[model samples]
Every structure is written in structure tokens, then in C-alpha cells.
Target chain A: MPVMDKLKAVSGTAAIVGVAESDQIGRTPDKGPLELHAEAGRNALADAGIDKSEVDGVFTAGYSTYDVAEYLGITPHFTDSTSVGGSSFVIHIAHAIAAIQAGYCEVALITHGQTGRSDRARAGGNPGLPSAQYEVPYGIIGPPVAYSLAANRYMHQYGEDRTREAMANIAVSTRKWANMNEKAFFYDTPMSFDEYHDSRWISWPFHLPDCCLVTDAGAAIVITSAERAKSTRKGAVSILGAAEGHDHGILHQMPDLTRTWGRHSGPQALEMAGVTHDDLDLAMIYDSFTYTVLATLESLGFCGPGDGPDFVADQRTAPGGDFPLNTSGGGLSYTHPGMYGIFTVVEAVRQLRGETGQRQLDDCKLAMAHGTGGLLSSTGTVILGRD
Target chain B: MADGYNKPIPIPQPESDNYWEGTKAGELRLRHCDDCNQAYFYPRNICPECGNNNTSWIVASGNAKIHTFAIVHRPPHPGFMDDIPYVPAIVELEEGPKMATQIVNVEADPSKISIDMAVKVVFESITDEISLPKFEPA
Candidate 1:
């Protein structure tokens, strides 16, 4: 899914025909990552109305490609375990589409599951090489601290109130959507700017509401050649366009503090899909932190740099608003489970299929699913379409 | 400096041995590429810019500016509980490369750490083998 400027634009040849999540989300110590993967994988196969034997390709993040294959008892001709943090699954969709177009595989199944909270399997930070020498010495660090550096810089660049208000709105608004999702972990828990502002600071400029929930969850998406999707009884969500790129593996080395590879992949993907920001009916952005959403909204061209505050004001991304984002509650309130990239796509596909019961967007034609991994380190964008 | 530093310290790579050695001698050492004449941190043998093997260590002037920072209120590791609410900052060396280091010698106040504030390097000997280079207001 690495889209160099020289590569050809991605033609929409693959469609995600099925998407599913495990029966449980918040806590599942009874299920490990592999068990969660199998549960979601089998359910996704059923959702696609296809048999397990028909799958020719398999993809997942943070695990050996053979684990899912061996567990599900299928021999796939193609498999990818490209672990670039959370965005791996989004990148997998692009790779699966390319593989299908190249006839490397016929049907691709992508799976992700983690017991981040239940098993305490979450990594504090990258150890051994770079982060150890540079980042860790300062203190025990994690994504929140690294992300906070960017958010703190953003506040220094813009008006403090504006950026703070913007960050608060992102957390509050996402919770508003979570209020509509019965499955959301934060269901019935509404957030306001006052609560957000008063919340205890984890990292300066970040509060309890600012950070994503650490929960256990699993998700899967099944994609096939667009032509094959046309014959399925389920309405398919085509991969309109997709692109992936990395700016830096380490946060301090990020080229721009306020931007990410999203600044590039977002445009490359939209150009490939032949769509614009105005064309998107829904946006399922990875929200590990409130600042993450603000930075991404700017980088994805939804708003200008340092303009995220104005763009998110007055609850624009909340329910019954002009832009409906993270309708599945997102990682902020729904489920994070370490790598959240797949869940973003899962929600996008579900929304496009009109499977989101009460929080579903009306007449959703096109939606964008974007994921950020490793502190704005890797970014991937996938635009899905119903038509 | 404290004895028996019980933290996850960096194990010097053969490529970066010079950096750790230099830290022991109270110097901030970084790699320089002879091909492109660019200096960089986290010492590596090969020049990342020109892909040239003609790289060597050079002592840094220790002058820098705060690029950005965050005060970590929650300790992600048990080793850092005593140092909770620490300020971790990214600093820009006068020579152009940036690094991740803690901003010491001042209160870890959010309003105090303005971006681009002038800073200088100071060393804290973690163990007998390693002394970390931390930044403080110049």
C-alpha cells in the first residue's frame, strides 16, 4: 500500500462485501488475539455469504500470517502480515485489491483482534533501539506523551483556547455519537466540554477524555473482486481508492509536528477515487487521542492547518450534524484493543451497508476510513462507496 | 547521579558505541557524513542522507532549542514512578538535527516550556556505563 508518487493511481477493482466484529468488545480475557481473530473471521465469512473454502487470500496485523490461516483451517495463496502498527489493516485492503487485480488472489479476508486491557498486552512504547536510547530515558513514555508533544506544539502555534476547545470538542462530540451506539463501551455516558476540560491531565494538553479507551475487541472485513461483489446478496462497499505512507517511525523525527503522511495519502487516495472532501458522507478516522482527530482532519484536507478548532466547533461531527464521523463510537468510546485500524474500516463498511441500526447515516453514498499508527508515524486512507 | 539505576537503559549498538562512550566522557557526540557534510543524532555508521559509509563522530556544541514538550503525568513504566510529571522534550540542535531528551534544571511546568526556548545539554550518569544527555534552559 506504499504509494510512491510514480505509481499508477489505484483503480477501484476490489469491494469489501462483508464486515463483522466479535460478539464482545470491552473485556474478553477468555479470548486471546487468535481466538478473537477466528471468531471475527468466521463471522465475516458468513456476512459475505461465502464459505471458508473459497477464501484465497488472508491479511491481518500484529500476528504471523499463518496463525489465522492455520486457525481457520484454510490454505491461502496470498497472505500479508505487514505490521506498521495500526494502519496495517488499512494498508492490507489496498494490497488485497492490488493482488486481486493482479490475479494473485480471488478473495481477501482481513482480521484484527487484541486483548489490550484484559491481558495487559499493550506495549508501553517501542523498546530496544531508537525509542529506548532517545525517548524512554526521559520517563516511562507511551503514545499519549508522544502525541502530546504534537498537541502541545499545536497549541503553542495557535491560540491556546482555540486548540484546547477544538481538542475538547473532538472528545465530547465522539462521545455524543457513542451515546447513540448501544454497543459502545461508553454507552449512556455523555461528555461535555466542561467535563473534558476538568478531567485530570494524563499528558499536558490531554485529559481522560482526550485518550482512547483501552478495551478488548476484534474485527474483520472480507473483500473480493468488484465483479464478484456484484453477484452477492449483500450490498457491497467498493474500495474506491486507497493509499499508505510513512513519514517517520519515531515521533520526534516526524517532518512536521502538525501534519502527517495523511497530508499526502489522503490526497493521493481521493485523486485515485476521483472524489473530494465534499463527496464523503461519513468519515471513520482513527481516534486514539482527541488531538489525533484534529490533526487528521487538517491533514486529510477537511480543514486547514491550525484551523481544526473552527472546523469542529458547535458539534459538527456529532449526531444529526452535517458531518457524521465515527458513527460506531470509534476507538475513543467504542474499542481500541491496541491496533484500531481494522475497526475503522469495519465501521465504514457497516455504515455503507446500512448495518448501523440507530446511528446510521442517511443515503450514505461514499465514506472515508483513515487510520493513524504510531504517533502520526504511519497513515492510510481508504474511501468506500455504495454506488 | 544515582547508583544502581534501575531503568531500561539503551544498550549501545556497535554502530553507536562512540556515542555512548562520548557520553561517559561528558561530551555530546553525533555522527557526521563526510559525503554530504550533514550531522545526525542516534549515532549510526552509515550516513542516512547520502548512504555513505564515510561517517564519523563529532562533538556537539550542546546548544539547542526546545522544539516541543509534554509533561507526562502518568508513568507508563514502573521505573519512572518517582519521576512522574516529568517533561519530555524534542530539541533541535544548532546543527539542524533534532533529538528526544528530557528538559531538566527547571520546574516541569506547562507554561514554562515555550517552543524554541534556548537550551543547553547536561548529563545525568544513569549507570557506570551510560550518562544521558538532558537539556536545560541555557
Candidate 2:
């Protein structure tokens, strides 16, 4: 189906009823992944003014206490534990919509939490599937190296000087946004584009600033039908559109290093949301790496490929800029406890409700949130609006 | 089960059986779609572009370009602890398709690595049955 039609179908049918987040500012050495999940789940239920036992559907990505149904101690009529990299939560939202539309459940809860700070050893261990015993010996390790390769390719395709400077500008702009968000990890420590240029490289074409911060925390949200949402505790943030797409799981399978499935899925999402880029007041793009955000911006038609660096360099994405992106500082400065996709949904809801003090946009009507997973392998886009 | 080596053992599904066998034989293999005339890796049952199941495996020349890479000063896995500051790279194979592999015999310095630098594959024997493909400055 065409993107716009797909979007219109979901319009006003389902709304995010409540959004809540655990403390994301600092390390939480006392918590484990499951504990945070439960806390966030409870908080979201409270925000929705719904009974804890009323949630009949549970969805989660990344680390959880146990099976989502078991961890939350709810017998969900529908359950999804889809973990397709970091964007899993966004994908779950789309799944939840299908479940709700099908009458499988009246209310669903999506949650995520991680004690990435406490589990330093596991955090530092070779970052790959634990079951893949054959590939690790050859030294296919963590996410940084995997994404670095793509960043390197992007620099080669674009001019080296321009690519480096553009990415630094992305960091600088995101950090500037972070400065306004007290919850962001780097709220006080701001860096300039030039400083980003001079910072030591974690991988070729990527500075320290280009990488996201490893954080420990949890975030959760409650979703239901628009009618059910209105009768609940908080005002509903209606879901205009949601879509997910996959290119390939392994990096070796991707068609190109620079372009990704986002090229296809992003448009599909906007078309489904029945809105154009001009209609969007803010965008909360996943920022596992600075390049991912830049890449998605171009792929989603905000700009053309290789134009992301320059598009960001002119302050188009900064606070008060025409395109205010990552107002919560994104994963670059916010809590990136493993998979941070759920937080994007939370921030989008807060923005739509005009709940974000200081960081909120004037008369913000529409928003776009994107999540990426598995070596730039998959993309999930959710378009939200205020009724 | 070695302390520093967590080699990924292949549990071959029908689609990827040949690719795993090829890795065991130290030959990098990829699938060529008969309809689209395009090559792809991480072998799939259906051709991504043409949706043709009539695809065949072909040996790669092992020549590629450094699409991108990163130097890990901190090893996240205990298996990688000894290899602190190792180079993990994505190499775009000459045949098309990018592979995640390590770049050997190169400085881990960011300035030394350039995008699209020529690279060639080198096999590293992890265990008796597995010989993983890596890359070096070619």
C-alpha cells in the first residue's frame, strides 16, 4: 500500500496514553535491567491512570527481567519480545497497533531498562550474539568498529575534509541541544565542531563525540485505542503512522555502506503518517552514532545523501532551528542503556502534549521518531501528532 | 570454551549451509542472483533484488575497499581483552556487499586509515573447523 494510506489507516485509531521514564541523568549502580523495566512499567501505568492488572498485552526489546509477561507478572493476551537491535521498541509499537486494531488487547505496555554501568565486564565483552561461536574468533567485535567501517566508506565517497567537519557539526549541534536538557548526560559539558574535529578517533572518520554515551536506565510507555486513551489518566498522543523495514542483518549483506533500508522505510513511514517533512515540528532520531542520524535524515528526505553533514552544519537541527531534532539530547547525551528506542516514543509523546518545559516547541503539532537496529540493518519510524 | 576465544559456531540453516561450509574451507563465498546478476553475502535463500531462489555460490576474489572501520581501545568482551586497540573494519568486497572483518597489519591510528583504501582478505584460523576471513592493507 502507499505510505499515506497506511498512515491514515492508523490515524486517531490508537494513541499513546501515558509516557514515563526513570532517572536517566546518572549511573544507577543499584539497579539491574529487569528492576528498571518493572519500575518504568509501573510508572507508565501510573501515568496512564490505569490499573496495573488492566494491561493485557506486553512488549519489550533488549534486556528484560525475564519473559515480558512473566517479568511484569501479567498474563498478556498478546506478547511480543521482538529484539531487532535498538529499534526494537519502535517496531513493537507498530506491532501493538496491529494487536489493538485486531482486538487482541485493549492496552499494551512497552518497556526497556539496562544497568549498562553496573555490568562493566559484560558491557566490555565482545559485542555480538553470544551463540555465534564461529565468527568471534576472527575478531568481529563491538558496534563501534562495525559502524566505523560505514563511516569510513561515507568519508571516502564524500570528500574527507567535508565529511569529518560535517559529522563534528552534528556532534556540536546535538551537544548544544543536550545543554538545554538537564536530563542529558552531557548537559553541562558542551563541545564545539572544531573540538570535535580535534578529538581522538575511536574509529576512522568518527571522533569520541561521534559515538553515543553508554548509559544505565529504563523508559516505558502505555498505548491503547484513542477512545480508551481519552478515558484513561493522561491525554492521548495519537499515533498517525508507524512502519518498520529491514535491509539485512549482517553488514556484509547490505547493498551499500552509506545508504540503508532507511532509504526505503523512512519514506514509507512519512507516507503512512500522511504528513510531509514540512508538517513535522520535531524529529527524535536514534543517535547510536552521529552518522546514523545524518544518514537517516537524508534517507528520510530531509536532505539528500552526503548532504546530511552540511544540512546539520548550518544549525537547521539545533534548538530554535527550523528542524528541532533530538530535543532530549538523543542517545548522544541521554541515556543509551543498550537499546534506547523506547525513549524516543516517550520523548515524542511528551513533546506532543507540550509537556517538555524549556525544551518544548511553540504550538508543536507533529513529530517523527526513528530507531535503527542491527548494523544499520533495520529501521523503525513512528509519526505522532496532537489531537 | 577458551577464556579469550569465543568463536562463533555456525548452526547452519538451509539458506546459509554453503556459506558456512565455504568459511570452513577458507574460501569467501557469496550468492549471485541469477535474475539481477548481483552478488550478496550472509547467504539468503532468495535474491534480495530479484526475489529469485535460483541463486548459486561463487568464490570471491577477496579484494575489497575499507568501507569504514573503528579502533577499540577498550575491549568489551574478555575474549578481546588481549587485543586492546584492535581494528574492526567493514570492507566492501570487489564483487559488491560489505563484510565485517578485522584489518590486520595496519596502525590502529584513525589518521592512518582512509575510506576506500584497497584491502585484501587473509584467513585467520580460530579453531580446527573455522578459518575466519580478515583484511589487510592491500
Candidate 3:
């Protein structure tokens, strides 16, 4: 069979039965990374009303799946630790669905946790990696530097002044959504265009406001066969479609700075779901930086190249707008525990279940959660719908 | 070189040994595949394009143009503290493959740099065994 046909065969075969975030997400100085994982795993299992013993599969990013499985006291028959940065959780969802169809595992639990702010989880580097040899030696220090390079290319391709305005609009608009979400770290703090424009630069073309916060958090999701989801507590969100891919491992090797792998994955997953762009009620795109959202919008075929600035103008993605996006404040205003892909999935499932109180959309039947990891190197898209 | 010169050093693997030797001799090198008629970067044995093991080393002209750049205001490591605002860029070689390098002998200002600006390679010897490849405005 063709690759697309094989992907479509697994459509709606698995559903997300439960999703939860660790209590006290931001700034958990007391809890370690493993403790956060355990907490989230326990909470998600409860939300699904499924016994811990029923979990036959385990998945996690960052830490080894063996560690998470052992820590959670789960001898899962199937285990995966697909660590491709933040997109791992999103990819795990897709992998879990396929694994269930193959009878490799029935109930799969995916979890993520990091003490990014209080302890700075990701502080070291691997000297053996290609980045260390090539880019790191030339002062390509952190993610902001690599991401700013891409942003600079985008601005050069588009109008600089226009691009800056569009980025500011994203920051302010995402903050508006954050105001409605009480759990958001920036819930009480609102942002303005002036504030975004005036913020000091972390890397040129990227103000502090444009970057994601490095807070601590843990999130988990429970997936099982669609038939088993019928007995779950809440309405199961069907796994309509999903796809994961990458163009390069490092920033400089990217075929195009302004374009991401999402261009391929987004359309592929949407095709498998048999849905059009108009079918989506909300879009949960990763916001490691404001520029990420803009570039992703174009890459996902939501807009054309260089049209992102105009597409997001006038707070189009803000709450109560025509296009509801990042409804959970996103990583920009929400808690970003280093790896934020799980949170995007969590928010998508919540919106599909009408669990979002103030930020909930009316009759939200279908939603899309897109994740980008490692300086736009890795991309994963999951299209979810309510039964 | 300044004292306490703490910076990351490129360790050459077996496949990349020729490329590093070329850099140490102030020559930029790239891997080329005769099977696919293409040149690539980041030293590997197999041709990424054709998966052909029949590949050899070729000397790059060191002439290139800036594809993209970033002015890093915050340094990631203490070694880079002196250069508070540095320009790290990806330059497209005349051979087609791009490389990550620093733009030296220029101010770290957006107005002073741009995309597709022509540049030429310059070697900065950090140690006896390694000479980092850098670029400057043509």
C-alpha cells in the first residue's frame, strides 16, 4: 500500500482518553524531573478512570522511557523514548496509535517534565554532536541565536517593519488568550505592542517578549483503542491524523530558513484526516518564539509565503477572533517546561472536551496541534476531533 | 590568542579528518559525490543525495554569500562574554552547500549586514591542531 493509505488506515483507530498537567506547573523548586513525571502520569490515569495496571505501553521524552516506566512502577509491554526535542510528545501520540493498531500495546501513556526555570534543566551540551563542532565553536550559543537567524531571514524575505509588527501582534494576541486562562503564568500580566517592541533584545530581531518562558512543568496524555475509549469518563477525542518529520538536525543545514518541515507534515496529516483547513475550530501551534508561530502559519499552508504578517495582523488569532489559536496562552504566556509539545496536546484535548472554561470555543469539534522542536528542525502535526 | 581562550574546539572524526586538515592549512573543504554530481558539508562517507560511497574531498573556493545571520546579544557561554554582541551566520558557499560561521572584522549591526551579501573565508587558528573557518565581507 502507499504510505498515505497506510497512514489513513490507522485514522480514528486510537483516541486520547485522558490528559492532565502536573499540579503547580511553574517554578517547582521542590520537585525533581522524575517526580513531576510521576505526578502527571498518576493524574492522567485518574482522569481516564483507568487503573495504573491497565497501562501496557509507556512513552516519554527527555528522560529514558525505562526510567519513566520504572518510576511509575509500570512494566509496560511496549515502551518508546522518542526524544526529538519538544516534538517528541506529539510524535509519541502518532506512534502510540500505530502501536495500538499493531497490538504492540493497548493503553499508552506519554509524559514530559522539566525544571527549566528553577533549576534550568537543559544547561549542558554534547561535545560529540555536530552542533558542538560546527555551530557552537562560532558562537551559536543557544536556541534564541539559532532562531533569530531564521527570523532575520524571514524579515529579509518579507518587509522588516511589517514582520516586526506581525510578531508584536502575536505576542499581544497570545497574551489576551492568557488573560482568560487562570493557570497561565502570565494570566495577570497583559502585553501591548509597545511593550513587545520596547523589550530588550535577546538576539537581534527577537525581543524578550518574543521568546518563550523557561518555567518548570509536567504534562501527560493517555491513549487507547477507540473501542476502549467508550468506557472512559470523558468524551474521547479521536486521533484523526498525525505526521512527524525533520529537514535537518541543526539550523544552518536547513534547506530554507523561512520554511519548516511542517509544510510537508501538516498537509500529510490533514490529508489522512480527510479534513480541510476550514474544518478546524482551533489551532494549537508551538510558540517557542513569536516568529515560530508566524513561520509555522505559512509552513502549515494556512497562509502563503510572506503573507504571514498580513494573516496575523489585527489580532486575528486572539480570543473571540475569527481564528482561535493558542487558546491556552501557548508557550509565550503559558508554562513552558522546556519541552512544551505535550502541553499543546493537552490544550487541544481540553478544548475538544469543552474543559477550557473562559478560553473555550463554541462547538469546537475539530482542532489541530502542531509542534516544532530544535530550532525548527523537527515538526509534528496531529489533527484531533470529537466524536 | 588571548590567555584563558576557552571556546569549543572541533574534534575531527575519521571521515572529517581531511576536512579539518584542509581548514588547518587555511583551505576550506567539502565532500563531493561523483555519482550524483553534488557537493555537501559536515563530512560523511556516503553521498547524502545518492547514498553512494564513491565520494572524495574537494577544496572549496572559500567565496560565499550570507544566507542568514543573527546578532546574539546574550552569550551562551562565558568564553563568548567579551564578544557580547556577535554575528553568527550561515553562509552559502559557491559550491552550493551552506556552512555555519562567524562574520568577523565587522560590526554586529543589522544595517551593516544583510542577506545574500558576498563574503570570503578567513581562518582563525584557535589551536595548533584546529583553525576555525570564519567569513568576512567581500
* Most TM-score-accurate candidate: 3
What would the per-residue lDDT of candidate 3 be over residues B1-138, giving only the tens digit for each residue? 536779777778777788889998999999999898889988889987889899988899999999999898887777788887999999999999999999999988999998999999999888888889999999
Best by lDDT: 3
Q: Write the per-residue lDDT of candidate 2 for residues A1-387, one digit (tens) a residue.
A: 444655567766888987888744358888777778888888899999988799988888775424655767888888888889888989888888989999999899998887776676553333333224323444555566567667767877777777776777667778888888788888899887677877886655567888888888888889999888889877788888888888776665567778877777677777777788888988999988888887778877888888887788777788878778888888887768778888888888888888888888898889988899888888888888896
Give stretches of model 3 more than 4 Å off: A121-123
The DockQ values of the predictions, listed in order, are 0.72, 0.43, 0.79
Clashes of each: 0, 22, 0
lDDT of 1 by residue, A62-162 (tens): 78879999999989999998998889999998899889988999989999888898886335544456877777777726788899998888888887889
All candidates: interface RMSD = 1.6, 4.4, 1.1
Q: Which model, 2 or 3, shows the larger TM-score?
A: 3
**Tens-digit per-residue lDDT, B1-138, candidate 2:** 233456344455566667667877878888888778889755776887777798888899999997777677655455676776888776789998766778889887778876679999887766565566789999
Q: Candidate 1, residue A194: CA error in Å?
A: 1.1
TM-score (C-alpha, index-matched) for candidate 2: 0.87
Looking at model 2, residue A250 earns an lDDT score of 61
Model 3 pairs whose backbones collide: none
